[model samples]
Target chain A: MATAEERSRLRDVPIPAIGGVRWLLGLVVPALLVVVWHLLVTTGVFAAHQLPEPLRVVGTLYAMGVAGDLWGHVAITLQRVFFGVLLGVAVGTGLGTLTGLSGLASDLLDPLLQSLKNIPSLAWVPLFLLWFGIGEGAKVLLIAVGAFFPVYLNLSTGIGEVSEDLLEVAEVYDLGRVEALRTVVFPAALPSLLVGIRGGVGLAWMFVVAAELIAASQGIGFLLSDGRVLARPDVIVGSILLFAFLGNLSDLAVKGVQRRVVDW
Target chain B: MADAPSEPTLSVRGLTKRYGDTVALADVDLAVRGGEFVAVVGPSGCGKSTLLRVLSGLEDRFEGRAAVDGDDVREGGSDAVGMVFQEPRLLPWTDVRGNVAVGLPADVDAADPDARARIDELIRIVGLGGFAERRPAELSGGMKQRVSLARGLAYDPSVLLLDEPFSALDRLTKHEQQDHLSDACAERGTTVVLVTHDVEEAAYLADRVVVLGDQPGRVETVVDVDADRPRERTDEDLLAVRARIVEALGV
Candidate 1:
């Protein structure tokens, strides 16, 4: 063992460099891609009408922004995705936990859920439109469908994977059934639950486009159809870029929460 | 009932455990007095840990009577027992304080200040005073085992069951932890039933070492140490006790 004096000598050692600004490295590829895109348009490889320049797309988005038309569409789409994810995750976690913890629930509910998950997101569009009509209900429910499966599947698998050793520890401590689940099983399954939430959020974005493409006056997905109808290639490309940016932003947020929850 | 003269803190009579065709333990019998430290030592497949699992109520299908604090092991008697498995088996998402709190008896409100004080005291006894905020992944193997020990002691059970808790440690850390455990249990006067494969560890820590034989484990011999506290590892008498335990295994 080190003496007090010797231990004190080690106290002044410098800390390692922090990972500040390392995230900027991720922007490099996108920046290069944008420059190449600009060159492809400028060098006349593609006609201006065939493919709009990067600046023109940005200019179109800026005009929509200045006219205050962009905010309403962005707000409505954000709201739909938000509520859809909320409803989906809530229902998914409930079913996932039930099926994960009980054999009876898994047996009764799993087959139907597994079958339902195989249906494509767009396939649900017409059925949902007919059922709930062309209102926000059908659109939000469609996105919710996309969000539900990943959380359900991931959480169910995560809870099932809890180690028997820890379960034995819980038994030894006399944690009882519910107490053991709260202390041992839930925390152990949290990482997988978070993983499912990230996937669910990604799917929600994909489904929102499908939801809006059929019937809606607002949302970024409608902008794609609207731009195509008007024969303005710039609007269509800008809408796609908006989807990518928002999808990545939400994913990053979920990842940040995952880091904090699974820090151990 | 035939031989037990007084009510023992822990008692096992005709304890037989089986998994299909294989018998892990058969007709094993043992009794321990209050505050006594008993260690069951045997070769790897001798079913010593099976005995511990039964005592701790992890295995409920045993064929005989095993009681802790006078209650049958299968019927809530295990509430009086605290167990430490070979692996730390801690929840990775929690810090030391929260993990230790998991062992608190059902009646104790974990949010209570008194409960927190007791948890902190157990942590201190296990020599982890300043590490209450540290997570399990931050600790070394020895430190993690120390946390496990603290957790086992948290509920203040009348009987503590250990399944080779220190068998994973290095030689030096194992010795230090054994000494720490010895001191803590001595102070609390907690009755202990430890199962380990290490004969020397049994000799060092147990008041009486129970050697179990291999096929369908049964008591081979019981060697009494009767040594003084804070015993010297190299003492002549300690070496004599170690020899007796090793010989009882017939290896």
Candidate 2:
């Protein structure tokens, strides 16, 4: 039994330690590079016109926030990511499980899906724009396309790696299909599923940027493009900074959930 | 000489398992009484684990009937039988308590006060009361196996099937575990079927050591361990049983 003090300590576990510090270390390098870039511009090592100073980027961000444009862009981008990832996770997991359970389905679909996954998500942008008409539909479809493969692959791998002994345990226990899945298969597969979600979260971010650059009218990607078209270096830099922050933040959030689910 | 009673709590007759063209256990027969500890020992790839799996009802793709308490083992019966694998195989995500409780009925509410109490007692019985909250990774191999043993016992099983459960442990730890296992089984009156390659371990623990031969396994001999319960490692009779097993295996 945990003492009252130990119980309190359990609650006090830092979300990052539970997730791991190495992933945070991965973010530090790019963040430091940005800081170094700002320092170079501030010290006149690079021309202000060519590379906007860090203060100018902050000023632009404040202006956008005050005018509520920042929230609008963030909201739109988030909505697209949410719908895409949700649809991808649902369909990918369902298909992945089916494939894992049935050898015939796995044999037919595995190679096809793997080959499609090899084609980068960005490569689909042009075709998606043509087929779905450069609208919300096209953007959501592209995000789903980006997120689907990693989640599906991970789910399938996880299901496949489940111990045969555990299956025997389930069989001996006389667990029905749903009960076996819930107690044995689900628990065994969760670590891998969470890993897939982490990979998918990053992919979703990548697609968000891709979607805005190629198809959407409003989003952080659009803001970045709009800044570039208007020759406003500060706005472009600010929007990029916002994407970096939110992308890192979202990755951290998924990682946090992964740690909780696979808490070892 | 007076004949012994032949009622078998577990009986296997002419059991045969083939994988494609390769036969595993062919025409093997054995009988085990309730509350008896039987250890099956053999050379490598002699299908000792295969025999245990079949008897546990995991390998139904075989010939002949394996009966438990006079009922034929026609299918995989996880609740009726409890198994400890070569590895602990605990769910890494579950804590010790949750892992042990996995063998219980899924809907049985493991959080119930009575179940929790039983789990707590079992943890102590298996010498893991202090490590209930630890995950599998946080545990040492012996500790993990202890948890596996606890989980198997938590099922309230009639027969405990162990597949080299202590094989992964160091020699010292293996002896410690053997002593504990013997004591625990005696107290609970749980029928145990242990599979091992170690002749000494089989001699030290089993009520009867069934020596098996390779190439489509068959029982060579059954060495009776008449050593008194709460047995000592240094006992002359136990060492003699070990000698008999080694001679039976021609090692």
Candidate 3:
């Protein structure tokens, strides 16, 4: 297991470098919001039941952490998103490449995919529930469905837009079909594919919450619903903030990978 | 080095190519003997590039025959043919050495020690010695084209087809590349067919210059340069040949 300092370095948080005025600029808005939140609570601008004090939410988070409930919910939510996004990327990339390379595949599949893309993630929840039941299957598939379209659209378009000059070079070299696709087509399309994966991962996080809200019993989304039943405003708002943090972290990870891989 | 042949290394007879309703080349005939340097010169729409494409086996839709070393080009004799396009066309993801290695024949063993040495030698020949690990984006345009030239020569092809490879460079860079190309090709004794619009370049580099006319592109004239190797740019013989090529091009 990594020590605390090593974990922080691995996360690349740059805490010691955050003392500058430039770094403090990012904290201004949150500070102002906190002051306003405190004023509202102390002045009784709204009922205490409707909007709890910010410190109360922090205390509630501490209580949940001490009880070991927070980590379990966070872990379960991350696991679902990971598996869903992986499966979605695999299927999307496969279909996208097939359609991009063959006119017949494009003609047969593009219309159906475009129509399916019009439906919102919430709209698919009912159908998925009916097809796969309210078990983990329906939730995972819902997240996958949400993640699929952006990857499909971006990858297909990227493959189609590879330079004709490079393709002609491949012909002159007499590279076989498989070799041409591997060397010429794939690398040329990589930047756009990275863009697709970033968007897909974002959608995966969004759909996970909706999936859990419908039928999940043990996830961050379930915590929100459970807090609602118990009339705990702090738990609901804390869950939303946690989701925001996790989503931003995932995006940063993807950007880091993109920078390292697509150096050209 | 292989023995030089007495017969023509590249032979094109009654070649014709048409795209849709436009005739790119019509009944053109040319031949380049073994180890000879030939340049095809013409005005903007005269199908010089198309002819090179046909000879290099990139275009197989032509009506007549083009052969390299007695084998029909259209039957996929890519191992015998190497091409340098107007642009470098280097894969951006690959470095200089990697780009040169891409030209090796499919059967060549990349893991073999000799193949790796050959790739390094080609890079050195192109004056990209210490920069083998640098990507194309880090190199200047002339440097990138040098990498392209090295790639064309990497596999020790029997024939090299260059489609205005130096036209994109400035004057000094073009002159330097021309000298580099002449020296490299002379050392290898590889048959070369270069397509250019510059008469002076054709006169200075090629053993014979074939001029093509536009509309239905066909051979107008073939001027032979009998000057010695490393001929001066202003030598009387090359000047006379350049003037004749300019007149034939009608420019």
lDDT tens readout by residue for model 2, B8-71: 6778899998889888898899988878999999888888888877877777688887878767
Task: Provide the TM-score of chain B versus the true chain B for each model in turn.
Answer: 0.92, 0.91, 0.92
- lDDT score, candidate 3, position B124: 84
True lDDT of residue A188, candidate 1: 89
lDDT of 3 by residue, A1-264 (tens): 469889878679664566465767887999999889988998999677888888988899889999999999999999999989998888889988988888899999989998998898889888888999999888888888877888898888889989988988887776668878988899998888888889999999989999998888889999888889899989998888889889999999999998999999
Q: Estimate the lDDT of model 1.
A: 0.89
- Of all native A–B interface contacts, model 1 reproduces a fraction of 0.89
* lDDT ranking, high to low: 1, 3, 2
- Which stretches in model 2 have alpha-carbon errors above 4 Å? A1-55, A104-112, A115-138, A172-176, B1-7, B18-24, B63-65, B69-79, B105-109, B166-189, B197-201, B214-216, B227-239
lDDT (10s digit) by residue, model 1, range A1-264: 477777776564322332476677789999999999999999999888778999999999999999999989889999999999998998899999999999899999999999999999999999998999999988888888899999999999889889999998888888989999999899888998899999999999999999987799999999989988998899999999999989999999999999988898
Mark the regions of model 3 whose C-alpha exceeds 4 Å error after superposition: A1-24, B1-7, B20-22, B69-72, B77-79, B168-173
Each model's number of backbone clashes? Answer: 0, 3, 0
Candidate 3: DockQ? 0.54
Candidate 3 chain A lDDT trough over 10 residues, lowest sum: A14-23
lDDT tens digits, residues A144-249, model 2?
8878888899999899989987887777555668877887898888887888877887898889889899776799999999988898899898888888888889
The true-versus-predicted C-alpha distance at residue B120 of model 3, in Å, is 1.3
Clashing pairs in 1: none
Q: TM-scores for all candidates?
A: 0.91, 0.80, 0.89
Positional deviation of residue A49's Cα in model 3 after best superposition, in angstroms: 3.1
Better of 1 and 3 by TM-score: 1
List the lowest-lDDT window of 10 residues for candidate 1 chain B.
Answer: B1-10
